[model samples]
Target chain A: MALSASTLKVGDTYEEQVVEDLKRTQLVQYAGASGDYNPVHTDEVFVTKVAGYPTVFAHGMLSMGMTGKMLTNYVGDGRLTQYGVRFTRQVWPGDSLTAKATVKAIRQEEGGHIVDLDVSTVNQDGVEVVSGYASARVDP
Target chain B: MMLEIDPKAKQGVQLGPVTVTAEDIQSFAEAMGDLNPLYTDVEAARAAGYPDVIAPPMFCMRMRGGRMLPEVPLPSGFMSLNAGQEIEFHDEIIAGQTYTITSRVADVYEKTGRSGPMEIIVRESTFTDAEGRTIVTIRERQIVRSPEKKI
Candidate 1:
């Protein structure tokens, strides 16, 4: 089935809840999978003693991954055409992250509907840790 | 130690002949605890008008193990940190499609911060579908910090 781009509109908003413990485990798993054993992510003691952080921090990619999840869920599969982001701050293990996406604009090109989106992940204190935009094609 | 690199010095490099499947997309969605029907339910996806179950936007980020960073000519004792990324999508991905990635070292530069001097390197990856259609282009920047600083 092809998605109709006409159904999506500007001002559409999507939100997701992020659990802290799940974030911690995901961070550890990412470390193991990516071989990024940075102490700031996996070692609380090292983070405290060496880096002076309050606790173990989540990997920046992990946060970005969470944002990607938000977009896929909102737009539906196969519709996502492009995604990117910038890491703004560190996410600690216990921090609650919220992912949000808002429709910014819609354009038609090459026989397809293109939707531009503003996406972001904000921590519990409301600081955006990751920010970027995504574009996708849908049936119109 | 002061390190010098030409910000304009860069070359294209290839990363994958990876096969993307619905299972991989599902796993990634599940791993992230996202239940968006667009990523899971085929009926919903169809109703939404996608040709098939599509992957998450950042799905390519998980395509690992094809290349080793150390194999590239990078400075020693410096840890790499993902700084930013920009991606442009060209086509929708279907399950069971094979892809070949061509990547290149795009640039290298230096920036001084309160912590010290940081080296920033950019890598660009182009994903081509099995039929040779270009699917996406990803530009990623990574910061390599001198190991002398513990942080």
Candidate 2:
């Protein structure tokens, strides 16, 4: 159900564990689906021997995409109007993530109720992986 | 060493007029581990008022590849990583609609963080439907860093 602005408060929040033990194969799946064939995301040899990273890492969009499931679940389908994020930290294989959304405002726009949210996703150790905001339509 | 990006690469380069298919939406949603019915069930999506199964909000990101610019030559041992993204959704991406994507290198700069100096590339892409209506806009930042040398 969509959130009801009449009953929603600015501090209301929703959270979810988006991913657990993120797998490298999942990154390959994302690369195929997203059409982003960047070697750094999947080719372990290239990423480590050539690019010099410790190992293959998760795509930032993957983190955002998983986090978005949390947002859409909270706001309801077809309700989101705006969503954006910054990759604050790298997400690695075996990392688990929790996404959170705190209501920042409940107001009306263009004759409809809207909810603004502060969006954040943190790794198992509590380090933020992605940080951003989102706005969605709500019921009055 | 500094990287050199071709001036022409900064201009908007068109990518596709690919049609969105139910399979595409389903695969993408499945890949992200999002089991939202609206993304996979046509009946559920229609009940929600969309003409067909709708893609998730970040679906536009798939079109972000097929590089808009030629690769910049980085230091021999440096790596480029996605730093962030800002997306604005004006409409839901419904299956059966054809969309075109145009991406450009918006900017390039440098900054120093705890890891030392890094180069940032900002790329912007716009997704428009067959009717030329803007569906979404995505601005992405990529960071280039070289590994530290051990003496």
Candidate 3:
């Protein structure tokens, strides 16, 4: 059954399972595949000394990817139409990151239903590291 | 050998006026395993208030994915890693629209840690539609680490 836009409402929150301890190796693999090998992500010393981070951190895109996965899974396949994000802070390794999306509004336009989502990522400290919005066409 | 880039020296160094097409967006969607309707379904998109099918938000990165050559003038080594990207959208990117990108080196800094020395480069990109209207602005940070440092 397709989930309709009307079924979703404002203040609806969804959370993704916390992956324990995002590793440096994962950052390396993302760097290898995505061509981002910035030292803050791969070099522990550089991350600590230069970036002033405690340890190497995860790539912003990697965190975005996880958030994207949550949306794709919740909205169901092919329902998401437009999505965008902004980086607010850096995500460090060993930090428990949670991706959350709240329905902001639902409107009828162009013969379909458009659902706008307020999406964000919060670390264990409850600080939002990334914030953005996504729009999707849901079954009316 | 560590390649050092003075961020101040390269400020506003435009890296792209790269043109992108609908086909490229489609190909990238496939590569990323994203099978969203908006990326592939025109009728569905039109019904959703879009004038036409649109690419995923992250699809903009593919514009820079045309394999860079070894002889290319990238500041670092032959290999370029995609450290990460940040995007802000002003409008949807539709099919058949020609887009141009302009990127500049934003910042460069060094850090030493348990592994070794690492160089960080921040690149800012502006993407404009065919009409010259800015569609999105992105800040991509790339970290180039010395290969000698092994965790």
User: Against the hidden reference, what TM-scores do the models get?
Assistant: 0.78, 0.92, 0.55
Candidate 3 ranges with C-alpha deviation above 4 Å: B1-151
Q: Please name the candidate that would achieve the greatest DockQ relative to the true structure.
A: 2
Q: Model 2, range A83-129, lDDT digits (tens) per residue?
A: 98988888999999999999999989999999999999999999999
RMSD for each of the candidates: 4.1, 2.4, 8.3
DockQ comparisons of all candidates to the true complex: 0.43, 0.67, 0.11
Best-matching candidate per lDDT: 2
Off by over 4 Å in 2: B1-3, B66-76, B147-151
C-alpha positional error of residue A15 in candidate 2 after TM-score superposition, expressed in Å: 0.3
List, residue by residue over A11-127, the lDDT tens digit for candidate 3. 787777434466666677655545545576788787676555568777667677667767766776456665666666777767777788888888898898988888888888889
**Which whole-number lDDT from 0 to 100 does residue B2 have in model 1?**
42
lDDT scores in order: 0.71, 0.86, 0.65
Better of 2 and 3 by lDDT: 2
At residue A19, candidate 3 shows an lDDT of 44
Q: Any idea what lDDT model 3 has?
A: 0.65
lDDT of 1 by residue, B20-116 (tens): 7776777766665665676677777778677667666656666533132323445675555677788777776556678887776666677875577
Candidate 1, superposed: residue stretches over 4 Å from native:
A1-12, A20-23, A32-40, A45-52, B1-9, B21-27, B35-54, B64-77, B92-95, B112-116, B147-151
